[model samples]
Target: MFQPTGQKRLTNVSVIRYKRGRKRFEIACYPSTVLSYRAGHLKDLSEVLQVDEVFENVSKGKVAASGDLRECFGTTDRAKIIRQILERGELQVSERERQYGLRNSLQEIANIIAAKTVSRATQRPIPVGLVYKALQEAHFSVQPTRSVKAQALEAIRLLQQHSELDLERARMRLRVHVPAQHDAKRLQERLVQIETDAAKKAKRGEVGSAAQVAAGASVRGGSDTSASLQMVQVESEEWLTGGALLWTLQIDPGWFRTLEQIVAEETHGSGTVEVISLRVLHEGDHLNDVL
Candidate 1:
């Protein structure tokens, strides 16, 4: 059995362990300090380490053997070895810490929901506190694998199901004439950022959602108008050089009044607005806010 080194005990400690081949090395660090260093918030390396000694077994307070360190690391420089381990080690956190981190990420989902959506009645953004309350009432949990926006969208679904809030994404669809180059360019910029194929071409799916993969994909340039290409597709040979375009776009409703002003100003009051249907979206309302 290895003799314990009888070092001073620590509270809220986590072990960062690195393994190579069949050998292992470890360091005991204060949980909060280690993350700060890793996140580049702490510059002094010594501040993060508890004992400043590499260990063979942290639980038993057993320091690593010098011979083993030399054989594995090719040098016995303690600082170099410790730096390597910290740079490429597995941080071991307790279950309570794990759950706490998850709660923070889930709360991020609530924040996203509040930012991208509004109360249907007031047409005003829902406050973050109330959104957080709705999340708890719906029993939402952290899904580490999914994007924050996707999870927030799912939480909104649950809120609607429970009738907790009559909230709509702050978005609207419009059928309007777009000016070539200027307005059309602005409109195309907001087009569904599509997924690419092996050939690097935009893979066409149902035209409703611009962001197909929720794996950190972006939501923009607009939405779900499976209205046939004949009806919904932007019409123009080349919209860049003053060719007129009849386009259907989905965008934040807040952008509507602004768009009307731009159109009328640019067209000298000749441009007009027409409404098709302002769809109070159901499941897949694309969003752009980041967490």
Candidate 2:
């Protein structure tokens, strides 16, 4: 529901590199715009009818000069500037369609650079030379400090070699853990119970015994001989068996919460729903057909 004014211009761009004990600030540009007027002639009398007899055209153009760098220094020096540039550049690239009107390829490059810089900053276990090489491969310039470069390379190597571990760590940071096998097994048992109990109550006129329910018999209330004598068949089909397991897992509290969040965010609303679990044992083939 938010809209941009479309009048904002790029400003305060800068770049830098560090080497030994010194820092080097490089040229950067922040683009601005201005309106320009150009002369043209009407080719026909009809053109005059659509506008003033003397027509003027206006064109938009960039007003900022090229190659200007803003300086940053001390403990917060070249590395810091590079980090800031990478972050801001990525943000601009992501919203480029609405910001600078850049292409997808350009945005991808920006993202890669940002990711590499952040990776290097956070984990510095690799050699500087390798980090520099990796950055060059990814089309990023390296800092002058040998220490920084070594750290960057170490981070890159770890990222490249143990991507799965890196991904697991990231997921852990987000507090997303996979459910254990035992938890899944318990959920499956609960599912079977709920299903068997509901089925017995449906088919019989009296409440069936616990053992009967576990054996997949429908409960019948009272001592009506005719109803009690009727046997309810439980299905043994593969599809039904598989579906029971699936249904059980689907209704798990963690699974349900995740699904609910996904649905709510997608629909942009808050709604409520009830989930139930069940369990049942094998009797005949009635469940297969009914399921």
Which candidate wins on lDDT? Answer: 1
Off by over 4 Å in 2: 1-132, 138-171, 174-291
Total clashes for model 2: 33
lDDT of 1 by residue, 63-165 (tens): 8889999999999999999988888998887889889877887789888888777776555667888988888887888775467777887777678668568
Any idea what lDDT model 1 has?
0.63
- Provide C-alpha RMSD values for all models, in order: 10.5, 25.4
Steric overlap count per candidate: 4, 33
Write the residue-wise lDDT of candidate 2 on 49-154 in tens digits: 2211110110111211112222222343433443343233222112333334322223333333233322212221233344334444544333222234344434
lDDT (CA) per prediction:
0.63, 0.28
For residue 197, model 1's alpha carbon misses the true position, in angstroms, by 19
